[model samples]
Target: MGAACIRERLDRALCSHPWIDRFPDTLVKHFTDQGSDHRGLLLSDKAYTRNSRPLFRFDARWADNPEVRAMVNYVWKEEIQGTPMFRLWERLKRLRHLLYDWSRAGTTNSLRNIKTLQAEIERIKLVHPVDWDEVRNLEFELNRQWEAEEIYKQLKSRVRWLKKGDQNSSYFHTVTRARRKRNFVAGLRSDNGDWVTEELGKADIATNFYQCLFTSETHVPNMAERVDNLPISQSITP
Candidate 1:
């Protein structure tokens, strides 16, 4: 038999029923062939736990609540005995924890709230009396939720051309998902010339690299002499 080069969609990923059941949210991605004739496939589970803690992001929607402003004012007014920079840093750290705690309890799932409010409004309309007041109240809440959802997606998408809360939630969502996929780091190459695919391994590699980079092993005994030795074309005399 002789080998022939031809373009065809012959490569595919196959999985057993048990495997699918175990990783229900698994996503398969295709990569272009580098040295081989066939494309490479990567499988990732969306629900897999991440090794590193997620970074905190401020949600602009939180500003809409009057209580959030009051909370910030209270945190800033707290007394802390320290140098100017140290006091500012401590206050910011405390404010971050305070806001995080408040946000966890104060924030509602906007999409879920929107759906629930919509359902309730529909139910209210179905009533024989059609309680107009109740429907109006529900509608108002639904609109607020919709705005929150829009602001969230807008922030994620980083798209500012279109004004947020203009009912372009779907567009923003699609852009956000695309950006996330583009920015995702599936794997990394370690300093030991090894591929690190697991999140923990990649994190370790990054941590070690940065630790070595920023940690100074040698101490300078004569810092003033070293600075004075540098050639200077011009000097300022006071």
Candidate 2:
């Protein structure tokens, strides 16, 4: 069929379909070419899919606990004392980095070295299998270390912001949103299989605060309600 006739047909179909709103976003078009013998029509629609899974979050409040602090210190000392497993891991890490550098430099020798190291590691694993429980413990320890580092960084950043005497409300709001997003993503996978998106609750809280702050009303009907139980102050009475 001619390009003009195909276009007209698609236009008519779009007009006739009042229930198009129910359907996903889509488009129909005719393609005419100088080289090709025939004209073609294409229809496209968007596919909806679930979001990626969120990572775990460490409890920052745990840092304040004496027992947790002691455990973290003990772990650090043990790591410093370097077991045979730690040596092996360090070697493996160095070898991997070397291979990466070589690959980026486009060197065949580096590529060969990476393959050799990988094969050797696999062979060792096959010969003497590592304990799954030990692996899990190590992974958990690594995650804890990373979380501690992040907490330190965030605290430092907050301190710096405070020292600068910058009372930018937007900055505080951004940090608050980030914390909420992280919390929501963390609570996603509980004991049950259901996915819980915490943003719904946080959104309500945020919206109320935003309206209270921005609205022109001189008296925002007990501003304490808008702050969501945050400890601001009680009162200044002589």
Candidate 3:
């Protein structure tokens, strides 16, 4: 019966933690309490799951598309009434969204249609290759789709040693799976000296370790000190 705009907005995802006030990972479901004026909050007892962030990389295939080039050129050259930095930032933001939209609209549908066309070609061939021209046309379409697929797979696998359009989608898939498996840590030791299997805990440990390792510390050796400490003898100096 009570009106709360923030409460209404956050009904699905409760930002406040169930136990501790921490970084947002909370979700809630509200239900009517029997004989009560206020709705009861049901806190999720399960561990919070982290959403996978999107990875955006440039696809070489898109470069060949005249339309894609025109789109990029148009967006890049759009005049914004602002200071140089502001204009650049706004343009970059727009470009990011544009590229994301473009990528989402890529070869998936074309490849799917190729499969359907392949089935149709097979059926027509069995019936007596009367649709020879149709088959040839579909083959051309398949070739185009394959090219896009190859470019996509190559970008994903980073295996540029092989020539393009070699029908290496399976190889690229295997490489990607293996890379993910190799990079994934099932568990990691936390600062508390316990094995933490939680994704958030492991991520925090890794982030902290790398940040500390890369950060400039209070006590550190400079390039001169590093040179002096080298194992090479003064007699063997170049």
Candidate with top TM-score is: 1
Off by over 4 Å in 2: 1-53, 56-61, 73-159, 163-171, 175-238
How many residue pairs clash in all the candidates, one count each? 0, 0, 0
Instruction: Report the poorest 10 consecutive residues by lDDT, candidate 2.
Output: 9-18
Could you say which candidate leads in lDDT? 1
All candidates' TM-scores?
0.54, 0.19, 0.47
Give residue 176's lDDT in candidate 2 (0 to 100): 48
- Over 1-238, each residue of candidate 1 has an lDDT whose tens digit, in order, gives 2477567765677766456546655767778877877888888787755766664567888886888788888878989875565567667668778777876773556878888888899888888989998888889888889888877777888987767558746666666655655566767898778978787787788767655544434354797897898777578679
Model 1 C-alpha lDDT versus the unseen true structure: 0.74
Q: Give residue 207's lDDT in candidate 2 (0 to 100).
A: 48
Tell me the tens digit of each residue's lDDT in model 3 across 3-121: 65343332343232223334223335568656854676776545455454444556677777787787779888898876565566667668777878876874445567668878877
Per-residue lDDT, model 2, residue 16, is 26
Candidate 2, backbone clash total:
0
Which runs of model 1 end up more than 4 angstroms from their true locations? 1-49, 163-170, 181-238
For each candidate, what is the lDDT?
A: 0.74, 0.45, 0.66
- Give the per-residue lDDT of model 2 (tens digit) for 79-173: 33344555444444444444344334533232244455455545545655665565555455444444444444445235343432233444444
Worst 10 residues of 1 by lDDT: 211-220
Look at candidate 1 and tell me the lDDT of residue 138: 86
